[model samples]
Target: MPANLTPQYHKAEEVYKQAKTSEEKIAALEEMLRAMPKHKGTDHLQADLKRRIAKLREEESRPKSKKAAFDPFRVEKGGAGQVLLLGAPNAGKSAIVARLTSAPTQPTPFPFATQGPIPGMMAHEDVQVQLVDLPPITPDYFPSGMLGLVKSADGALLVADLSSDLVLDDLETILAKVSEGRVRLFDPAVQTAGAPADSDEVLLVRIPALLLANKGDADGAQDRLELLRELYQGRFDPLVISAETQEGLDRLPGAVFGMLKRIRIYSKEPGKPVDRSSPFVLKEGDTVLDLAARIHRDFPEHLKQARVWGSARFEGQAVQRDYVLRDRDVVELQVDL
Candidate 1:
């Protein structure tokens, strides 16, 4: 089968050619990869693109000449997962971060108060989720490394200021800017809505997004939110919040955790009690074997049967390696000496 490349892929290729910086080139290449039709015909091309991308990333990570010294975008991901706070200028992105985490935020009435990416840990029950407050994105101005950061995040919270009548326009502008990089935002209901139902030829990064209508305490905020709901018509389930008032802020962490779609698994030694404080996080529907492999490199090859505690039919019940693990499940692996 011939590789039926789309117009979007060709556009990305053009951008890649015109890119002046390594980061810009990488972003364009990634956009190309996302836009390319995934088929056997493009498998080799995909592999080659991936190889080039890896090489570029490796080159960028290494120390270069004295002129290229600092890299501000290199954020080490921590906690359960990283969630990006994204929106147009002064959409309350900084305010939201300040309310949720201890990270110092410059939340003023002025736009573009945040000039760099700021990561903060938001506690969700026993675990912590990394939330990065990114510079506001707009059609005229998007930070060079913003796309990469958004693409690498587990999920995103698209904030809109309910106090302003331009809220809907701001939301649309943000979406358009992201889409130009081949990234699409959708809720669970419209996950597959962007692609054609009959074909698998589409290439797009469909990110799970939560619409946050901030400044809920503002005058006429309720009317704005109602209009927003009517405008989107269930496409985006907007979460009304007041970062200053702390109203609806408590539920933000839980909503972010749910968007991550990850499960927590506790591990135990032969005779020791399960360490409940720290959990080995895995994507939902992962198997016991996956947890074993994560625990140790040799566990998968030299392991025997395993016993389960939480989410098991019985306490300490023996389970095979293929047993599907559940959230908060405690696993005790018995490996052969």
Candidate 2:
């Protein structure tokens, strides 16, 4: 029997061939399985893929040696969401990250000062968003496993150096490289209308991205901004900011948090005051039942109703399990004992 595969499966196979890490391989294999024709002819192939998946998962679970090789690309996710800081050499990614998170970034008057991924926590109101300063990417300096990291991230912040004349060239290269990796950068407003119909040739990981035109305080920065607008022309309306002067940064934390499409909820006891310090971050459209489940594994089984504070018709109004949550909504769960 001939195993006639679809174009999507072939595309995934190419990705699998190029995969450098177990995570990337597993992702590709899963895609392949999803796109493969479900017929007796593909039975052997299906079993083979399953076996490969199991093997990769086992390898992932296996403990690493203390003396094992360090993976500069691997960054374990932390905080509410992980956002990657991508840019060309000396594009001021490190400086912006330092300003946002107060993390140490030893700035040198040189390119490639950052050697690997530097993870920092940027506080957005009550929640912390992880901003990773990835090593500078250029046509000649794209590190291995970079795309995998980008694909795994919640969002991205691409910084462009307004102080440099060759900023456009660098930006062009950065965009091209990510596109080749099948990662599409959306401005958050775009692509939320509806996901692209799943196609055989396209399996893009669409991410909400914001372009920051750095060094807005520098001379000729405004001219450079105009040029960028003309060059990319409607494709990007870059956010202007000065990492050195901290101008136009008052809304940056909120902007990044908005990209995650997340809402912070305050869980409360029936008679106790809500703890506004630490919020239970939930998806923007998550329900009261979702919050109950997050509170405890067995909560949904006993969930009866909830009292709302923020989005209720009136204060302390009793809502059903399916009531949608809004940001900062104080939810008092009433689960049967």
Candidate 3:
């Protein structure tokens, strides 16, 4: 196991080491799931463990005792980016997922029908974002732990009904629940919506938001759209879309990617792009020195200086890594190399 996985391995070992029976072994496996890293490398190991754990647990619990109706819907992380979709019932979330990714989803008319999170993905150029359509939230079934997942997502898409008054109430309920990220309506004409041009109200969290008014083909949609726009005081660009027809799905990925910030810069060494796809994603104004520290502790201390060869300060300008890097600024390090 890699050093990064050591902690989890040790945890699992400790849990299983003292287990004397199948039941205890099953409990240990559950702990491993909580601790193990979820990635390609661990896929097989995870699957085997889950199988063993399930078999053991199945034997332990008789049909009557088994409370595990089994939420077969486990949250599988997709793509490098994650965009969580939230809304009330009948918000066309499943349609959005069906149109965007190849994931198989059952689209139907019902509230809270999606018992758990459904993850799908779409690519924007070379980058891909996983969109998770979670169970619909109504005043009756607003679970606390489920809300936490939305708070940590990279971005959020809030769906609404353009033809109904129920949307307003849903919006208010959602606003009350979000602990992180700002809320902004999306524009039907545009994909990525900005804060109102006139208002100086700074978004509480710069986390991107998409306000989608679904059922564009329905009657009174335009009237509802205008009403929603006024309700938000045009702070957000409200998007009127018909997910049923897959309208505006092409722009969906772009809108998501636009909200995400990423810029590639070359490394100090020849033939090295700083691997923008590395586990650590940084923003502008972060220094190459900062990246060095993140990559490894020794690299930062041994670092001498850096040379550049991209758009930051014109080509081939040698500068110290402390010199904050701008987006697309190539950095060649003069470290132990």
Candidate 4:
């Protein structure tokens, strides 16, 4: 069973990483375990994967039915991308959501605030991304059904209260609850780990998070902020801001948008040319065939070749659908006419 073990494991892990929800991750892990070979070397690995899977399942079922049912949640469908915000109590998650998007969010100062997910639409340079604000979670808090929501996010912003000396404690507590290992930041150069085995869920969380230290305007907050960043050892790109006065708020949108690895490309159709003003935003790794598939699955199947007439070159250069497309590049599909 050593045949193709490496590649098979890799692909499964990739899928698990891309999975947006805990349910999806769990399903992927089960399959990985099934595909993996049973041997002495893999025994420990298998056991660890199974234990993690069980923990996810157990945490998913921790809350009561009434409490779970009462969780206010919304999943926004239309957007270039989506980001979920994570933080502890009074961390200004709701305020940031309200400041960035056109969502009517309630900003309160109580513990266990925002008992559910609130969806908001954020627009940037004609592109729109959805943001979700989830309920505050402490070190010991693992509310039922919240894991799935966090897993679904394209990216996550870890918010902290810089004005308070306990900001570092907050980060450690929150990270302990939701994260595992180094989260991938969608870097094209760095390859992912070995493929996943059956029953092992890959959490492809985009990391190098945008760390926000709220209450920047408060006295002595700046010094505390520096100390926190140094303590993290550049693990996070820290931004000091006051959600109330909107200080440093302008940069938050950019940070969120930048995390999205997607780029826009226009398609020059055979008969009807694609619109450049409103192009589709796709992840960086997507190839011309990927775009074709997005436009129509059959496009890739029947796609004989394609032509490019943008950034990569001048005029139109005929090419294959597998050609990797770049940001702002214009492509023309040569299909059966």
Worst 10 residues of 1 by lDDT: 193-202
Give per-residue CA lDDT, model 4, range 1-337, as digits (tens).
Answer: 2334555566666777887766667756755665666554564465567666767766665665664554444364458777778888888999989988878788987777587788898877767878888888787775645665665456777788876778788888778776543233321222323333332334333333467788888888888888876876535657778899999888776666666677888877776866777887887756776687668746766778788877556668876554668877888887663
RMSD of 4: 8.4
lDDT of 1 at 103: 89
Cα error, candidate 2, residue 238 (Å): 1.1
Best by lDDT: 2
TM-score of 1: 0.78
Using all chains and alpha carbons, the TM-scores for the candidates as numbered come to 0.78, 0.79, 0.63, 0.74
Q: List the residue pairs that clash in candidate 3.
A: 185-237, 186-237, 186-238, 186-239, 188-239, 267-331, 268-331, 268-332, 268-333
Kindly report which residue stretches of model 2 are placed more than 4 angstroms away from their true locations once superposed. Answer: 1-69, 190-194
RMSD of 3: 13.2
Candidate 3 per-residue C-alpha lDDT over 37-100 given as tens digits, one digit per residue, 9 for 90 to 100: 6554664565567567657855654443466554333354556567778888887888788788
Cα deviation of 66, candidate 2, in Å: 6.9
lDDT of 4: 0.69
Query: Where is model 4 poorest over a 10-residue stretch in terms of lDDT?
Result: 185-194
Q: After TM-score superposition, what is the CA distance of residue 207 in candidate 2 from its true location, in Å?
A: 1.2
Where in model 1 is the C-alpha error above 4 Å?
A: 1-71, 189-202
lDDT of each: 0.81, 0.82, 0.63, 0.69
Question: What lDDT is reached at residue 280 by model 4?
Answer: 78
Please give the clash total of every predicted structure, in order.
0, 0, 9, 8
